[model samples]
Target: MTITTTRPEPASADLGTDPQEPAGRRVLTGDRPTGPLHLGHYFGTLRNRVRLQRQGAELFVVVADYQVITDRDIADRLAEHSENLVIDYLATGLDPESATIFAHSAVPALNQLLLPFLSLVSVAELGRNPTVKDEIAHSRQSSVSGLMFTYPVHQAADILFCKADLVPVGQDQLPHLEVARTVARRFNERYGAGIFPRPRALLSEAPLLPGTDGGKMSKSRGNAIALAADEDETARLVRGARTDAERRISYDPAGRPGVAGLLQLAALCQDRTPGQLAEEIGNGGAAALKRTVTEAVNEHLRPIRARRAELAADRAHIRQVLRTGAERANAVADATLAEVRAAMGAVGSA
Candidate 1:
């Protein structure tokens, strides 16, 4: 597969939560902003978040800027990149009113809880985290910064600070969620209190969206289909995707990752199963299959692009949304941190 892509203008229309009553469980989730969000983001968790919003669940989306800097000694573009990430998010339909959105840097209270929570968790356990190992290897930085090593601790702070009852994450992150639960459990066990409810993983239903090169669809791989990518760019990436030499189409991820990725993307956008899509491919070769999937993706993302541009135009409005979200998030987080302090006997006693 070979793809030719165009740079797309950011969109701003609200495909986000509309006027609806709240639903069953409260959910919390967010992304790190090393770059703009891609299709993997959409198919992975954003889709689930939007659906939950319509169902009337109180959802919190964190920008997670602080987490991104864990490996870097210092960053020159942190502020700029963080703003762009927020723009991509709002452009993609994160309504400030419906879902709370805040950056990790803006909330000092949440970070305060980390010291105490870390005390409750054993270092031996943190060392065993697979994510830590994977991330360190990816960074290829001789050794990880303390911040990087305990990135999961900050994650716990993010969740526990909000008193999150439910956290939506991918399967790869169950361990971090487990860590958050452990911190909550140990604190409650030792403090004679249950200040933080153990949050459960909501989990993603969509299959992991693959990158253009047939690897994991991450920004670092350059294999992603960025949500902000223009139609031509979308088409191009679809074209360049690695497919099987078989010349005919089949939906076997193990056998044809490139073809299977296209199928997966199409299946997600079309709301059909990969098997359902495979039957439609008929005798078409990989090129034909890629075209069909490309069209489906381009059509689906058109509106999101338009909306992202509209949102991008009003940078101030986007900032205001984060400000409001921070204020709202801080209100809850401050209260939680206070309780956490009291639990650790940091607060006044008789």
Candidate 2:
């Protein structure tokens, strides 16, 4: 896919930065609380979030519970999943003091912003979103829900509600962020410029890790290594991972996906490239590759697992963190909504 280099129109000076935001730039990124976050999530975005937070980017991580329900048949698991998600976040090194982490449902004002933004985009446009189409195919659902189809609109709300200047996303998600940018531009054109800063994609450079079966890492596939997985579970999963015969340890994703996938996993854990790891472990064979990957993965996750265990034991503290984050997120969301309402001349209660 071609990437766009055009910048959004300059935001209005009056719609300046939010006070609560840090001195530098701001970012908004999150995960759908469907299940425990996996290694895919860590390499994909979580690690970047941690670094950006340390760099003083005003970061907000959302537990996108609202988005999870679109294709899920069992909504009851959402509450538990959402809580576990926060544990993964903290355990993965996201400092609550540095970044605000909140549930999407907690910020009611964000939902209120979605309605007006929907008017800016058409049904055909949403259908045309590459990310949306890909997600639909991945879901393998015969029928699509309205909520699922219009997820881009909800995502726009998530970004704009906080007036996030940057969104950390992978290449596949550029279209989704573009949808948010389009909505922002349309809103500015209709009402006023600069109300929304037109969030840009802070593209992740990390290589995408495939699952044990050589497909995308997903919980449904039962091939992912969850960040919270214990040492034995992690080892078992890696040992059973699919690899090829006559494997002289190579990094050819297209030709030898299974072995290359294990190499990628090892590379990510070791902070090196797959090709480098492949060269280092030449002629080691698939068994050797699996052992290396399993050891590296378990070693890396040891601290995260320990921290998650400690945090998981404190359910009340987790709830309090969400509650506190929600309060702060609501302030920013409410302020943005007020501006949106006033721009459209919508009446507010006295």
Best by TM-score: 2
lDDT of each: 0.78, 0.84
Poorest lDDT segment (10 consecutive residues) of candidate 1:
1-10
- lDDT of prediction 1: 0.78
By lDDT, who's the top model here? 2
Q: After the best TM-score superposition of candidate 1, give how far the Cα of residue 10 lies from its true spot, in angstroms.
A: 36
lDDT of 1 by residue, 36-76 (tens): 78999887777667777777778888888887767665564
Point out the worst 10-residue segment of candidate 2 by lDDT. 8-17
Local error of candidate 1 at residue 204 (angstroms): 1.2
Model 1: lDDT of residue 231: 92
Q: What is the per-residue lDDT of model 2 for residues 67-118, given as tens digits with 9 covering 90 to 100?
A: 8867755466888999998998899889887688999999999998989988
